[model samples]
Target chain A: MSATVDVAVIGATGAVGEALVQVLEERDFPLKTLHLLGVDEAVGHSVTFRGKNLRVRAADEFDFANVQVAFFVDEADVTRECLEAVRRGGCAVIDLSAGLPAGQAPIVVADVNPQVMASLKAPYWVSSPAAVSVALSCVLAAIAGQVEVTRASVTACLAVSSRDRQGVTELARQTAELLNARAMEPRLFDRQIAFNLLAQVEEPDNSGHGALERRIGNELKTLLTRPQLKVAVTCIQAPVFFGDSLNVSLQTEAAVDIPAVCAALDASPAIEYVEPGDYPTAVGDAVGQDVIYVGRVRGGIEDEREVNLWITSDNVRKGTAVNAVQLAELLIKDHLSKILT
Target chain B: MSATVDVAVIGATGAVGEALVQVLEERDFPLKTLHLLGVDEAVGHSVTFRGKNLRVRAADEFDFANVQVAFFVDEADVTRECLEAVRRGGCAVIDLSAGLPAGQAPIVVADVNPQVMASLKAPYWVSSPAAVSVALSCVLAAIAGQVEVTRASVTACLAVSSRDRQGVTELARQTAELLNARAMEPRLFDRQIAFNLLAQVEEPDNSGHGALERRIGNELKTLLTRPQLKVAVTCIQAPVFFGDSLNVSLQTEAAVDIPAVCAALDASPAIEYVEPGDYPTAVGDAVGQDVIYVGRVRGGIEDEREVNLWITSDNVRKGTAVNAVQLAELLIKDHLSKILT
Candidate 1:
């Protein structure tokens, strides 16, 4: 394995993409060279990395063979389009766009399912799950030692940034208009998301489950390797701009020990466990942090076997970018030689 | 029963109180006289009823003996202070403050538990549950006809108005401040409530459940008449000005029949069912509506015995005022003579 590897970041101008570059710099990731690539309007935007202005080039024109590993931060359609090229270039791929199916590239959370990486060969392709799934799996995987979860239900309050920068712009515009006593014309979302909760983040299938909701459920199961676990997910679009907050309820085989669960969360490096009396909010505690903020941890009202949790996470940083980087770190630490060969 | 009955609305200056007066006027209740009463700051205000402005008097000095029924909408402390006088006045009490314990005044939702009225005597002291409870019970009770729900978990995304008119003002203030590039100074809520999801609406207890969350759980159990049912409640403060949205997951004894569940929700007069592929939001459909909007109904991804639903309801109108009026109508229809004596 080399001391440093050349890396390319696709979709370098979006929220997650911008954060990916920032996280790589913040963590001082070992990189010999960094290539910023984007598509359409994203191309030519300048992002600051290591005190240098790196201009994003067209992702369509960039040669994937130049980099040892590539982080795909674009939307699923774009990621799907470039998959073959990346494979042909023999570059390892870490997907944050949820483009590749789990069957083709296993969904791996660095802290939760790093073991999955050991089974991969050259031209390694790994997928990072959605932000909600990443936040949930971090805490749930920490507590797997204490309880065997049979069923889990999550109500994820997603930020507008999940829709990209346009979402952030629209929320600010809608809010300003509404505040100044002007009419609100919702743009990015179907309706006004300024100060309201949209029941579904996207249109659902016939079964009444939205695409993101299904993706979250599938990712959690794969990350936990619990195909039989019953996961019910409802993803609502919140007016928030930065972080995602989730209300999770789990049914376990045995009674949940509250203290034990707290201890487990407290010990996890990926989570910051707030005490029972104090809770964490997305804006107040988790907007820019590197770790998921977990609080409001307790048992059920009537059933001892039930456990409820409130988790707040930085949607872009820790949930997506930082996680992808951690996976990259693991690959560089153990599988770098195989990929470089 | 007489042709008309004198009614009094205590704490008639706040959000719920204001909605209560409007509902009474909209419903055209058989009221011989309408009295609007309030506490210190609420006095001197006027509420319009039947096209006439009604002055708000001091609740401390008002005579409960003058009205056959009184709707207590003040805080629990005020409700407690005035309870003795009301009982002595032989006035039928419909408490909305949640001031009285369940043992002292049984919590009742008109549609969910009309039969509980038969168990009451004169000088009725019936309690209206919290807005979240009313909204949830309406939908859950409707589904109880189709499935035997053994457990229910809910994530209630409450609007800012749940804290009263002041909460609404603070969110608007915070949002405007943030939009104009000014610093946010959170007042009503512990932290910024604008464009954020607050994990706990109120301070939680040692067990990590907030007062409102616990109240919702207990109220659901009582309203459903299922003492052994497991209920998990998490009330989050959302940025919305009005309308509360809840993501509810229920576990029934048998596999949930999707068609039957949809039919039951559709048939319920108190609920407005939204078909699959389309959904409702707090601002889009339920701000001032009288019926609770139910949508996103589906089964769990892996568990057949689970059912998930998204519900949006006017916390002030349908949840509190309308439900209270419906209870008043029920009392008038069957037990009016007993109270008028």
Candidate 2:
């Protein structure tokens, strides 16, 4: 932790990637140099870091050996392509993409399972869970010691930004066209997402689970260290521009102590617990926040063992960028010396 | 079946009320006279029934005794105020506003529990469940015969129209204002309902359950006749304007038979079972439809006893108007003599 560390951010031009860079600056990371890199489409874009514009370079041409850590914020394919280079350079990898499966790298959420980092050796590789998983896990982790969660059902209403820049542009265009009483074809999404909810963000496999849905479920189990926990997930695309709204219901082994749950949530650094009377919405509360907003907390209508929660999290800021940056902080605090050696 | 029936529709200017009139006309109900009644605000408006303009008269002045049955489609308060008059008028009541408690009037979904109608005595009063309840009950009922549902967790993504015409107008106004970068105050909803997801549709009770959420849970229990079945519901307001989208996960007593479940859903005349891979959306598949569109049907990620489904239903059409009309038809077919006498 003595010397400043050098880091590279892949896919620097996308929404989450840009937010990652901004977070790094805002958090004042101990960085000697910042490498902004992306695929060919993003090569010409420039991102501001520490009040200086850094041009995004071609990721394939960048030398990963120059940096001690690399944040893979690109799509899965790009991450898969650059994994070997980062491993060869002996750089610690914090993947925002679900490129490396759980077996390849343990999924880590800084607020939930930072202790998982202790087992990793040099050139550490960690996978960051999806935004919904990150938000849910943090809240779940805060209260896990009080009650054993038996099962959870989550309905993730994802913002257009979850699909990145193209998604944001399409939503704006579609909404404008519809407002103007003009019919327009949907691009990026399968159907009209301007004022409609797309049931699945992506095409489901033969088993009918959306890719993101399965990923969130798996990530929650891994991050929470409860492999046997039954997690049901449904990821639907919302018309929202920037936040992910989740409707979560959990069943615990015993009756949930309402006061204790609220106390735990309010005490968590990574969560902002909203009171019962007032609730949070994605646009109204979580659009640019660093912490996930949790509200409308209540027990089941009949079963005291059940708990319901509404969570709104900024998909780019808290969900991806902040968590990834936080993971980097943990890496530097505990494993910096190992990586530098 | 014996003779044409006379009917009165209170609150004939609202979205559901108008749709109810259309459905009645489309179904070609055996009708000698149709009475469209409303409050002071609706007194000047007129609804077209069977190709003729029917003026909406003041409901407080209208004699309910003129009609054999009355469809109360106004607010809960209005419905409550008119209940005694309707009862004194000896007019059978189908309360769509949920004004009367289940004890006073049995909540019924035509497709799921038409048998409940047989239990009613003369001047029968029945309550049409909420849109979410009606849609979910129909789907759950179709599969309940095959698998004993031990528990269910539902995320009801409601469209703006659920709030009625005002809600629709407010959403359009908000979206327009936001798009134009004009800051405007939220009208009906607490916050922006244009491009955001509101965690709860209404002010939740002290227990943290929204009124609609609790009602849906109770209605499902009564409709399925599974009083002991555990039902958890979260009702959220989505940006969509017309259809109500529901994400339902059910845990059965035994492992779900996917093929059998599909067969039952397809066989049911009340639902249009969508195959895997292709899903139904609120605007694309369910709006203006008579049947609820069911899609994204699958088993759980790891558990075989779990089944998940996505349902999009026309909240104004199938959820309320169609169900109410069907209930009227049911009453007329069976209790024509009882009512006329």
* Residues A130-173, model 2: lDDT tens digits: 88889999999998977899999998899999989999999999
Model 2 Cα shift for residue B261 (angstroms): 0.3
Candidate 1 residue spans exceeding 4 A from truth: A337-341, B337-341
True contacts kept of each: 0.94, 0.92
The per-residue C-alpha lDDT of model 1 at residue B10 equals 90
What are the interface RMSDs of all the models? 0.9, 0.7
Q: How well is candidate 1 docked (DockQ)?
A: 0.86
DockQ of each: 0.86, 0.88
Candidate 2 segments exceeding 4 Å error: A337-341, B337-341
Predicted candidate 1 versus true structure: per-residue lDDT over A1-341, tens digit per residue: 45688999999999999999999999999898999998888888999999999999988787898998899999888898887788778889999987876577888999898988888777789998999999999998999999899989899989999988988998889888888889777887998988888888888887888889888888888899998888999998899999999999999999889899999999999999999878899989999999999998899877889899999999999999999999998888778954455
Give chain A TM for each model in order: 0.97, 0.97
lDDT of 1 by residue, B1-341 (tens): 45578999998999999999999888888889999998888899898888888999988887888988899988988888887788778888899998875588788898899888767777777999999999999898998879999988899989988989999899888888888889777897888888888888888887888888888888888898898888999998889999999999999999989999999999999899999988899888998999999999999877889999999999999999998888888778778855455
- Model 2 residue pairs with clashes: none
Full-model lDDT for every candidate? 0.89, 0.90
lDDT of 2 at B132: 90
TM-score for the B chain of model 2: 0.97
